[model samples]
Target: MTNEKRLPPLLKLALELGPLALFFVANAYADRFGFAEGQRIFFATALFIGATLVALAVSYALLRKLPIMPLVSGVVVVVFGGLTLFLQDETFIKLKPTIVNTMFGAILLGGLYFRKPLLEIVLDSVFDLTEEGWRKLTLRWALFFFTLAALNEIVWRTQSTDFWVSFKVFGIMPLTIAFALAQTPLLLRHEAKKAEEA
Candidate 1:
């Protein structure tokens, strides 16, 4: 609520998604670029790392500050991605989502344990809600994050590299969007009235 203008939703989505899209594309065509069968993921990880940094830079350039969630995610991407490239291990990159989601889940739940709703801060305080509403919403998001972390673990452990990449791009994004849209009713129901305007 600092009166700073947020990025347009579509633009924000693009910035958030552009790296993933590029990662997918890079992985899909790594063979055409002559990377070995086992090296495709590594190649894609390099691109993903670069794209994430670029996206963060763009966000900072536009807003003069980075969003908390993306900045945290980007840091993990770079770290895990670097490990993947330097060590020639796909496990690090594959585990990145699981680690990130679990961290977010724990953070949210920990906040609630202390009677704080950290989601509001993470979301830049965009939504004004009653305390109960905030608690409920934060709890829902925490569980959702845990679910995503579990899903990522299952997929990455059991699926092929290509399949895991596809799921990360296709599966997770749609699920998140659906979940968010499904919260509209809760948000509307709990919206705080501007008593000061009376």
Candidate 2:
């Protein structure tokens, strides 16, 4: 993709986050519009599927390439969301986070087992870190993903559907952003060390 055609940060964030916001809104009003409980969830799942496709399309159109993270997420969303609507079981959708997070954690940690820091590939465009820094950051993220997977299982199994939906929409994103922000000092320190070596 040409630099000029690349999506700006704000627009990219919107593409990634808009579908989730739509899902939350759709679920919130599903009942007021008289949808039955099952149908409400089905409606929200359907909307999520459509919104994910739209977001991916917009990303490709503007950036000329699909982002790796969102592409994986979009695929899972369609698959699990389809199963949820097809089986009329909310369990499928609720299990999506657990599956996705577990997969990510495994991929990252497995890369470390092979002495490769896969996070460097994912975030290299945004961060410049020493080799040790990449290893540390990758380990931290792997643990964090595992924690999120466990939390998803607990929340979905114990909570009401609406509560789970709210947690998915409101809870996860903030936690991720906060976690990323908390690593800023580590990131800056590593970048400074790299600069000194250069």
Candidate 3:
């Protein structure tokens, strides 16, 4: 196996966020670039698929392995994006976020049902926590993912395509970041408690 340096946090964030940024940009300017209304969604979906593949390739190059969440998400993007293009239906792409988020939420909650706090698997490298802390954090994240799924459904059903794209790009990201930051205190407390016990 080849040894590879772990990606820096900023570079990791860029790899994850860059594809969504490209999708949003492509959609926003599709019309000015002379794509018809019907063609804009297809154009954006194609761009999104390409960007997601590039992101995955970059992640593997840096980390020497694909991250689970992004691998799952990239698969969904490519499949749904391809359906959107093949069927010429924008709804497939619109529904992708809802499906992906719901799947994640279900998996997390299901892990709890099986007496496993699976968030630890994803986050253990970055955090030290008691079992109770892991359980609480996992529950919080599961609920958050469900909330995001519901929000995506509501936005796509009620809002314009452009509005939904903006919400996906701007709203969901900030909310996730804020939620993660808000958990810092709890994480620190758990770490301290673990240290004390040690």
All candidates: CA RMSD in angstroms? 1.8, 2.2, 2.6
Write candidate 2's Cα lDDT for 42-77 as tens digits: 888899999999999989987788877789889999
Q: Write one digit per residue (lDDT tens) for candidate 3, span 1-198.
A: 123356888999889999999999999899998999768878989999999999999999877799789999999999999999999999999999999999999999999999899998887777878888888899999999999999999999999888998999999999999999999988987784566687
Best candidate according to TM-score: 1
What ranges in model 3 sit over 4 Å off?
Answer: 1-5, 192-195
Can you rank all candidates by TM-score, best first? 1, 3, 2
TM-score of each: 0.95, 0.93, 0.94
Task: Provide the lowest-lDDT 10-residue window in model 3.
Answer: 1-10
Off by over 4 Å in 2: 1-6, 192-198
In candidate 3 the C-alpha lDDT for residue 29 amounts to 92
Clashing pairs in 1: none
Off by over 4 Å in 1: 194-198
Error of 2 at 67 (Å): 1.3
Q: State each model's CA lDDT, in order.
A: 0.92, 0.89, 0.90
**Candidate 2: deviation at residue 68, Å?**
1.2
Q: Poorest 10 consecutive residues of model 1 by lDDT?
A: 189-198
